[model samples]
Target: MPMTSTPTPAMAKQTPKQPPTPTAKATKATPTRKRPKLCPPDVTDRRRRPAGRIAPEALAAERGSALEGLDWLGRPPEATASLLYRLLRLVARFIIFVVFRFRIRTSGQENIPAGGYFLVAAAHRGWMDPFLVMQALPSQPRCWFLGSAPSTFTSRWRERLIHRLGGLLPVWRGGVGIDQHVASARAVIANGAVFAQMPEGTVSGPAGLIGPFRTGWAVIALRVDAPIVPLAIAGTEELYLGRRMVSRVLPVTSARALAGLDHGAEMPPPGTREELDVARRMSDALAAIIGPVVESIHPRTVDPVEHPRRFRRRLTWLFLRPGRLDRDG
Candidate 1:
């Protein structure tokens, strides 16, 4: 076996001085994007509009088609009162007074303006409330009603009958074609005929429990410079034979008075904050005036014993829309 030679320090080849292994340059981290914050349904954001309310532009587009075949707006109220209207009104009177035997007691007939046009703002409790009001008034100058087109024109016959009646100014709720409705109402009031409307907007709530009154009627009254007669109706909520209904007409509320203006003062321009303020004030005033009368006549709490089960469901079914009675209030 050969003995191995011990290698000297110099004999070991110098390790190659290679370039330091390149350290990976610290990679700049890419930032993750943040998601947008979502708001809850109940949260009212100033930047966003409330749901279910139509934007003004979309409402404008709908107005044209809404009033398209409603030629009655062009004619005066008297022109549309044909023979059919008179006969139908007579039949309605017979049904209300003779068939149903509803004893209508009225007061404040003196409060109604003698000659010029005015508005009758009432609480709508039943389907026959309008006819009851018509019966309460003098039959010479028929009152034109601002009726919901959807509710009033449910069938083709109803639409034709309403059109022939000549006293209905059909309005699309939820701000559809409101301009045309206001215009038609103004024309009706200007023609020396009374215009009537339910400020509650619909037949909701129990008798004497008036809903929040809408300001649309106030707006129309202001525009036409007419007085709003607050008419309180009770006992029409449940109709039956020998039902006694009372209609009381409160004092007249003039547009000037409602706007907080003195006689001979000009009204605020339409769509102005001042005009809206006036409308709200008028609505509140009318509600206050009519609420007490309603409550006095027909209290909110009913004694089940007094209102018997006899003909209750059947009578309610006869006058009210099926499954749509808004008694929840």
Candidate 2:
């Protein structure tokens, strides 16, 4: 028989009992810590962090820009016009200023530039738009306006006066005489004065609703590498072509208008989608100066608008051009 050994009292005393496992109820009762949200607790304040204060460097840059603008203004005109041009400009300025007593408020006039070539892409609200923009300037700088022919100077006397004054040049739409129109415009800028055109091609309204821009202005800007200044003319919608002559009959307050200039936005590569996109953007800038009057009357419809295939490529579009329509249906 094999000998059997029994454990000693000391060894038995060394063994320890295991602790009990937690029950399902106990585990479920424990609270879990949650991860914090990235955004602020108050949705209204939305900012995750405090607004950044303007840096000193930014302030210095602004001052430098202002100084540069002054230097530009002090520079000489690109080219001088004849004495006759000067006299005509002065007379027209006097008529608009002293006679009509047109009151205008302007913002961002500094963007007119110091020298060289630039074009004003004005939003046409009524016949007086060109006159309003021209007179709004602090200095009466001579500008050649591109007008629509057959319709611009309807009467013989009006035609003769405009021709003699050497201010208005006609641009025939529908591909008729477009080249000549462009050439004449080039000549004007070559002589140092600025050229202005109502890019909307027609009057939209006083409230600043702009229509499609004609490509002629964009082509000119690209060819000369000239900057295009966006100009918005407001408060002259009531002075439509029919009412312009008798505008003085209205209260002096009705003659008041506002024009705002947006800093020059350089033209992108010519003939590219960017060209059309930029022109549209400039139209939007011109609309801002018209104020909220028109908007209140015909509040913009929130419905979606359809656009052409070419326009779809624009990354900066708010949504198909505001007034675009579907190709079919």
Candidate 3:
């Protein structure tokens, strides 16, 4: 009796190896719940939780975002949906006032993607193209509209508005300021926003053939290793019923995004002999999409574009740098 001992129930129940970690017990004891996604809006609306904690089943009855007034006009959506709507409407004002009267239609809108940053290039046909392209766009993958090249005539309010809407970028008017521009464009792309530019330089006006292709666009694309999307719009002059027919013409033309390859270092430098050759090929590629209409369609006739003071100042450093020659005795 003295030697006999009853086995303890606790000892019989335990048969483990190593000790458990502190976090292991905590994790095992707690149940994890998934978080709700707050990305872009969905195709369909889900019901709102009543009492701020609606059951999953209650989601069927909730209303989504509201669009009252012209609040939804802004482009380049903000973190908040309501804000995005407002920005979208703001961008639309240009179209409503100017482009709609021209009947500027947008064709090949299917070409524009729904999201992310890109390098958007359009053949400069008329001053009207930027307004038409920006306003009539079907989608803005988080638009960051770059303003026109520095012009002396731009109003302060207009400048402020362009920047406020995230539409401000400098463009070199002529010659080969390609490398310098690529630096500026790189900043935009790096920031995860779109960089929009007109490769045609100033408006085509009624005169001047579409001019030779500018290599700066290709250079920037290759430098950033970004896709170069060519935008071809026609009918600004042809469709201009002064201010009425702009609506019809707005929808015409085509847009193509050449996401082919990075075009990286493999591509020639802009303005170089090699670059010129490549740019010509790109121009031809765009021409194929636009066809004969562009050849015959004249630019919306307008006065020559003038550079603004601020732009001229910035460009002075890049463009007006005279070569300093050392005169030796």
Candidate 4:
């Protein structure tokens, strides 16, 4: 055999490599894990949130007690003029006359209806303005006031005293207890008495400046079909002895007429856009009527230098509660 040789040791160990076969475990699909949904924090968690963030029902219930411990609104309209009311009015008048020596002057007394329900809308400048208006009006049908509960009832004694006097209809600010307030006001009007309110809502800046009027008065007047007797008070902003306080009653007008709506026309449902528009127009008309009167009596801007020297500075703080004496204007 021509050149046939024996294989080497390295050639015997060498072989061709091949791909491995696939198995069932390698072809299977992996499962996906689902995540949990997120949610808002609980309002009842007192430690984590503020106390004011309570439920609507809880808030209403809390605010409904604003007039609690007072029996004024529970009485019949005719019976609302209790003896305490007359006595308190007399005492207030005595203080105004003898203690303060304030000269009371009134104009357009004839504008006030002799015997009927009416609304007295006035610009509020000070705590004493309400008492001044009460003094100016006749005492027959007692006047009921829609007062801010927090401002009026600052203490237990004040709350008790005001409750005993029996003429205030407590209303909380920020729209709490609004329905009850409207109902009480309507009751006062239906009782054939005067309902006095400050259209500016709270004491605005010094005596002469009138703040923007709110629509509550206009809305209530329209709903009750009562005439509004605009009252412009002057000289109570800054108080001193021998001050001349004037209560001028403007012409009596109806909210419906002021809003340019037909007399006795049905009002849109409460809180509706149409109703709001009507109230706004009525409030604007009211402001137009009363603005000039107030400005004429009291200058728009008062200089501190022109203020009369108060011998006893405490006299200026007479109407303000002790708690508010230190507060700045």
Write down the TM-score of every candidate.
Answer: 0.72, 0.48, 0.49, 0.71
| lDDT, model 3 | 0.43
How does each model score on lDDT? 0.68, 0.46, 0.43, 0.67
How does residue 124 of candidate 4 score in lDDT? 77
Candidate 2, 89-200: lDDT as tens digits: 6896685566544444455556565434454544454556666666544333456677654344335586556555555666433333344555655665666666666656
Better of 3 and 4 by TM-score: 4
TM-score, candidate 4, is 0.71
Tell how far residue 169 is off in model 4, in angstroms: 0.5
Q: Give the C-alpha lDDT of model 4.
A: 0.67
lDDT of 3 at 101: 34
Measured with C-alpha atoms, the lDDT of residue 313 in candidate 4 is 46
TM-score, cand. 2 vs. native = 0.48
Model 2 misplacement above 4 A: 1-82, 88-90, 138-141, 240-329
Candidate 3 ranges beyond 4 A from true positions:
1-91, 94-100, 116-123, 136-139, 144-148, 172-176, 205-209, 238-265, 269-276, 291-329
Pairs that collide, model 1: none
Clashes of each: 0, 0, 39, 0
Off by over 4 Å in 4: 1-65, 68-72, 77-80, 299-308, 311-313, 319-329
Ranking by TM-score: 1, 4, 3, 2
Candidate 4: clashing pairs of residues: none
